[model samples]
Target: MELNSIKDAFDRVAKKQKLSCSKSQEVIDQIIQEIEKALGKIQPSLSDYKHVLSDLRTTLKDIAPLSQLEGTQKELNIALSKYAKVIEKSFNPDIAKAYRNIEFDVHTVNQIIAIHFYRQGFFDIGDCFISEARELESAASIKSSFLEMFQILEAMKHWNLEPALNWAANNSDKLKQNGSDLVLRLHSMQFLEILKKGSRNEALKYARNHLTPFSSDHMAELQKLMACLLFTGRLDSSPYSALISPTNWEKLAEELSKQFCNILGYSFESPLSVTIAAGVQGLPPLLKFMNVMAGKKQEWQTMKQLPVPVELDKEFQFHSVFVCPVSKEQSTDDNPPMLMPCGHVLCKQSIMKMSKNSTKSFKCPYCPSDVEATKCRQLYL
Candidate 1:
């Protein structure tokens, strides 16, 4: 009885290990019994099943957790949200439509869309602000805002923006204290432009009143303003006496010459004894050379002065004095024979003699080397 109990216990353990159900275990036992009975009559041995049951039991322990995968999915969603706006701003309409359908907050997405519209030239700046305000349902400030000021000046000549100008004038103190240098510079240029068309006393008064006081380091700006006033015939020469030093006068002369030449056809060879810009005071060396060239009174004024032979040796070596290329003339009595590669000058007769040699290549008069006559350039003289 004890031996029977031990055998039954071993059979139960084997059935549990094989994952055989109670109902299936009885059927398996009957099949094993039948197989064992037939084994005596059978001739060959074969495998029980094609797959290993142990390997199937090993795969049940390695399942993935849902929490870790959910975290990754959340991160992917956030990343997608950030990039969707960028994709929506692309030039391709199909790409934009794909990005627009992506789930994300609408604020940044709409801003990016508006910016893209502006970049694609769909709307001008004024219209862009109008659209932005309408979409946002917000009231915008009208006075001294960057947009307002830009529009004011954009339409200033045609539109009587006295109110905007008055606001700018009244807020000059606050603007200097709080506004950037770029803003101040913009205002200054605008003031100058407006001042150009104003009456003499009125313009000066408005410039002095509205514009910031000039700094000594900004002498260039002061000079520019003075030049503008003088050029417009708003101020007489006597009023700008302090601004017109001799050096400043020279600069102004060159500026006027350049401006007049650009407007008309030619610049003055020298100062017209008038006020010009103050920066171009010193004459460039090229201008100095041109001035000298223009002032030539002799017959060689229009011609370049070729080098003249100061000394000549029996070996036909000629030493010449150098002159400007613009002053040479065939009429000069001091014409010198041009030197060749052999450092020897030959007269016209010697050159003609070389030209007669058809059978043999021309040789240098002073040296035995071939003249390489085919490569020789004709002498300009």
Candidate 2:
């Protein structure tokens, strides 16, 4: 919410700035036109220069260009001043108050940074960073895997598919295990490229050889792809025109990168990218919480959790988060969610407190059944 508000503020400031500049430019243009008219009149009356100068002064007084320009300039200055205040109001400068000082493993941090660079296809930079951190040996395997992925992506940029097809074929089993139809997709892209060349027989042969395995499972998709063959070189004019859409190339590239990372036991997004994205999403609440705590003379940096919930978007959620209904607290390792024999769930701490550490039974919070902590098994979300 804070980020959106800041963006909206910036947009309003930008609009005001453009309007002010436009008004100022209009006044300047008008002044320039009046001066040019005075010059033209003087040019034709050089012999009567003194009279012309007097007339020019009178014309300037009638137009009052300086006054108009001064008004426009004042509006601009006012907009600029308001813009600075809006920025100050929109974002807290004391963001450091929200931070916690904690020890971090230097080696682990270096490895993560190195791997992030590698995953982002910054091979040379990754090598340099890891080498300076003395993590080249530890990060070599990851770099090699990403290097292969980047090689495939590089080929893709030039409309080449052989490298990608080979990688897909080698990881065929893994792709299937990961529930990815990358092989079929790759083959379909190739088939379409062949059709674009007006090679009907070649496309058919390639489809039979490479797309055959996915035929039964993806019959519906295969049917649609096959429909493109009817258009051959004129696919743009065919009923299956969308088959040749430029977006398909971009989508396929993204899907390929995702599957490539998935097969390598990694997410398509680099950890650094996801962390920064999630952090930015969560920062506004943390900053707000810190300011609220400041008035009460409270120290929040040493705390394990924030007083307010930081709601992040779904894309930032990578794992399950179970909040106990009884205590309204999120489950952690020490306070894991527990499943009762009666089928209700609560945090272990909540259950322990209710049952007095399993010394006695207590009525279930949601049902009439009596519950014991010993009868509750840890439930992994």
Candidate 3:
């Protein structure tokens, strides 16, 4: 809703700006036309066109657009000021106070951001940042991996699959273990490219050489590809024509990015990007909570954890977490989650407290079964 308000405000400002510009232009054109008319009536041999010049000057003075133009310009300025106020009200600038007590390692942060730039193919900016920040070693170490990824992506952008094919071929076994069909997908693209170029025989040969290996796993898809051969020079009109949709190339590029990142033990998105996305998702709730805490005169900075949960999407979830139902505390390394014999999990500290330091057995908090704390096993996420 706030976004819509901001957009509407911008639209109003833009409309007023356009109106002001058009009015100003109209005024200038009118003045120029009057001047031209007065010039056209002038006689070079006689200085007797004073009446015509006077009429042109009177016409210019009587022009009424200047007032309207000034009004529009004032409206535009007022609209812009209102838009800035909307932004200021929607975003709480005091939110940064939530992190005022936290200490940051500037050097480490600079290196991480610099490496993120390098990984995204901004080599010049990354290099300049690294040189300025004295993080040459850290940037140099991961440069080759990102460089190779960019080269393959660049080739894919131009519809050249050779580099990607070679990379997939080299990592064939690992790719298969990871359940990636990237090699077959690339081969399918190559086959389609060949078919599109009116080379039925070459497409057949390419399919035989490249697509045959995936026959057992992808029989239905292979059959569809084979059916394209029957159409030969008219694949676009064939039943399997949907395979030639432009979106397939886009999906292939996404798949290749995922596979490449998986092979390199890196996230598909840059770490810095992921961090920023998560922070953006979590910031609103945090700011609201902080405001509430301030109103109540509570000590939010000293709190061990947030009083409310800041829910994020699945993409930002990097690992599983367990919070003890009995103690209302999150599981941590010092108090790792443990599974009881009754099939319920609780933090080690909570179990120990319920069992009175494990001296006796206690009933499960959510079940009637009796269980001993010593018998509980630690659970790993």
Candidate 4:
């Protein structure tokens, strides 16, 4: 909502600026036109035309565009001031305090961020950062790997698949282990390209050498591809036309990126990107909480944990977390999750409390199993 308000304010300022410019231009044009008319009326050979010059000046002074231009400039200034205030109010001056006393190693952070830029193909920026930070060795190791991946992706954008095909084939075993059908997908795209270009025979041959191997597991999709051959160059009008959607290329590129990252044992997203995204999602609540606790200086300063939970999407959830039903507390190293014989999980603290400091067996909170806390196994995520 705040974003919308800011956008509206920006739009108003832009509109006012354009109006002011148009009115100013109109005023200048009118004055020039009146002076030209006055000059045309005066004799070219005559050095005297004082009355004509006076009339031109009077006409210029009476022009409505001059007053309109002034009003527009005033409106433009008002719009600009309003936008400035909106921007100022939108920023929370105390937001920086949320990172109070947190220590960061500048060199290490620069190296990580620089590597992230390199991985995203911002080589010049990354190089500059590395040079300034003098952390060449740190970013040098993974640079070539990301550069190669980018090269392959760049080729994929132009519908070339040979580089990706060879890479996938060389890493065939790893792809298989990871259950990635990247090679098959790449081959399918190649086959579709052949079919699109009116080469039915080539498409069939390509599919036979490629898609046939995956028939056992991908029989349905294989059948669809085979049916697409009937349409040949007219696949756009075929029942399987959805297969030829331009978005398929985008989806394939995304899938290829995921497969590439998986093969390298790295996350599909850059760590820096993920960190920034998570921060963007979590910062608002933290800022609001800080504003609410502004009066409690000592309490906020000494607080080690957030008073409220910051919810993030499942995509950002990188690990399993167990919250104890009894205590309504999250499991940590000091209070690890425990699995009872009844298959119910609870934090160690909750189990300890329920078992009365291991003095006796306790019934499961949601079940009838009476188990000893000592016998409960620690569960790791």
Candidate 5:
């Protein structure tokens, strides 16, 4: 059948007189009880029951014209109203099946109802739709439902959340047992990013409650997240310093500098001090370097400032005591090199080398700037 024609037919049937509001609701309640029973009983081979039920519900509205027999037509119309109630029950897993039939008719139906629930602050219903979409094995529907919740969260401006924290807390063993390293890391990073931009109370709550578990392995990312959280008033203080030992302080500082440069297009040489000043604890390496570099510059620019002066220092100073001259064979003009914040050393020659590669955006070793090789002061280390 043509799509429009099918839609018209369904609309007609949906608007048609069938069951009274009370009778329809009762039928809906009965269907929901059946679904819950099916779920709880754990049928050995109910492979396509949900799909069958969903399709049946859709057909009840649209297939009336084609279905033969007098009673079949009536049955179909009654089923449509009933299925909607089932959807409501499916959303609340805790609801008892024997609840009295209420005459409250939802103004919306099906997918629209799911959307309304999401917008109306009924997250359990939204989650039910998500679960159903997943059960139906529709990736698109699952993603759509997930995105809807995200939009809701955005609307609430609760970017950082306790749900994410609770998730991490309760599922640690499951995550580890199931080898969810990448997913866990991604979730952690995303949650931390949100917290960094949240209120201090909430951010610190997240840090104190959530940051402790993966501190050792993902310290670099965590430190950066914490720093941002503190700066943004998400965290009360640098709650992660104790996690990072003094011996590893430089490493943490370096990571922070690099991350800041990466995230904010600014670098700090004394990132640790800046973190400390912000009342945060540990500084990643990159931030430390960036803070120091910024402090030495003729014009100092912190996170608050932008468009700092760009002075490319030609000479390079290697910070490492065990520095060895890069082999000439390994050296090429095309090799992209970076200068450290102290104008000390060149790192990553490959980023500069290769024709037109210099045009690719990179940080100045001496100062973090989005620039091409022409702006770089060639370091003759």
Candidate 6:
């Protein structure tokens, strides 16, 4: 759906409604002012009361408030009608038509939700879910892994880096294998924290013991830390003030959390988050396609793949997409790509059709090699 176009239509409707309301209020105010003026002109005597009433009637008729109100009401009605039409055109109110009845894995759904809770650092709630759900003992191990991550994060909250530094030192080899500079960065933060306590000697000792080893790879950064010793407690007032920004701490904490997840063989974002985000982006097209199918009275409920492509943002694409060269169709679980013995790939459906339902051999369309449908192996990607 074109959101900008819908927004433009909505803005037009809102503007029209505002203008109509403003005009109506203005006309009503004018009519009220005229009536009040006519009332003020009356003398305080029963003899003059009937004469004042007669004058008010003629004055109100001259002001013509009813005609003005009718005109304003007509404009408001027109605006409302246009607004309704715009909503109908831009939105599909019957969104339930987009999906069909299908079986779902209740246990797997529960597991995903539980893991999401653990990844978000809600271990108590996650434990509650695990305790309530049947046969979910496996999630206990997953929760244990995240416990260390949250522990380090909690320490970093209080300006304490001991837990994080210890974890980094312990996993220095694995961290290097992942090409991560997390260890050195952690040391640098710790060094700065020590310097901030007005302990120049302690800071120098920390630099020599922990920061010197990283100097071979990060000489410039290490030199900056050494230079910071001159400014001592007044680092914020010195030329190295940029290092005092809270963003550095926040960014390092985030980085530590990410790498910790990576070391545990998990994505930085929880799987549930990725799925919901992708689903949100893909839902519009699916809903639109379903609407079209419903209009045509066609059946798409049992189709293995969506009739239309659901394009999602790049960040949501965690894996590669393979499109078959022979049939020009994207691969899905039901119709996965098959790798032929001849070093060629095609969709399983295409190969089955070409080989006459696997009853006979057929020549490869891209090459001269004779192929049998049974000889093709399904490729995962």
lDDT (Cα atoms) of all candidates against the true structure: 0.42, 0.84, 0.85, 0.85, 0.45, 0.84
- Residue pairs with colliding backbones in model 6 are none
**lDDT for residue 85 in candidate 4, whole number 0-100:** 97
Ranking by TM-score: 2, 6, 4, 3, 1, 5
Q: If both were scored by TM-score, which would come out higher, candidate 2 or candidate 3?
A: 2
TM-score of every candidate: 0.26, 0.85, 0.74, 0.75, 0.20, 0.78
Q: Give per-residue CA lDDT, model 3, range 1-381, as digits (tens).
A: 878998898898899889988888888888888888788778563476878878877887788666757887898899999999998977887767455365779887997788688777898888888889987776786777778978998998888999999999999998999999899999998898788788999999999899998899999989988888888777788786778777888899889988988887777888899999998888888888777677643477666666778899999998997889988887887899999998999999998998999999999989899999999999998
lDDT of 4 by residue, 239-330 (tens): 98888687998898888888887776677888898998998888888888877777876787675656778899898999987778888877
Best by TM-score: 2
What lDDT score goes with residue 94 in model 1?
Answer: 29
Regions more than 4 Å wrong, model 5: 1-160, 181-205, 233-381
lDDT of 6 by residue, 108-226 (tens): 88888888998898988998988888636678688888888898999998888999999998999989999999988888888788778889999999888988887778899988889
Against the true structure, candidate 3 reaches a TM-score of 0.74
* Clashing residue pairs found in predicted model 4: none
Model 5 root mean square deviation, Cα atoms: 29.2
For candidate 2, write residues 1-381 as lDDT tens digits. Answer: 746766766676677678767877887787688778778887877887777778777877887767766765676677667767777877778778777777999998897899899988888999999888988678989999999989998898878889999998899899889888788878888898899889999998988888877877999999998888788998888888777687887888899999988888887788888898998888888887777787653456556655689999999887899999999998888899999989999999999898888899998989999887787999887
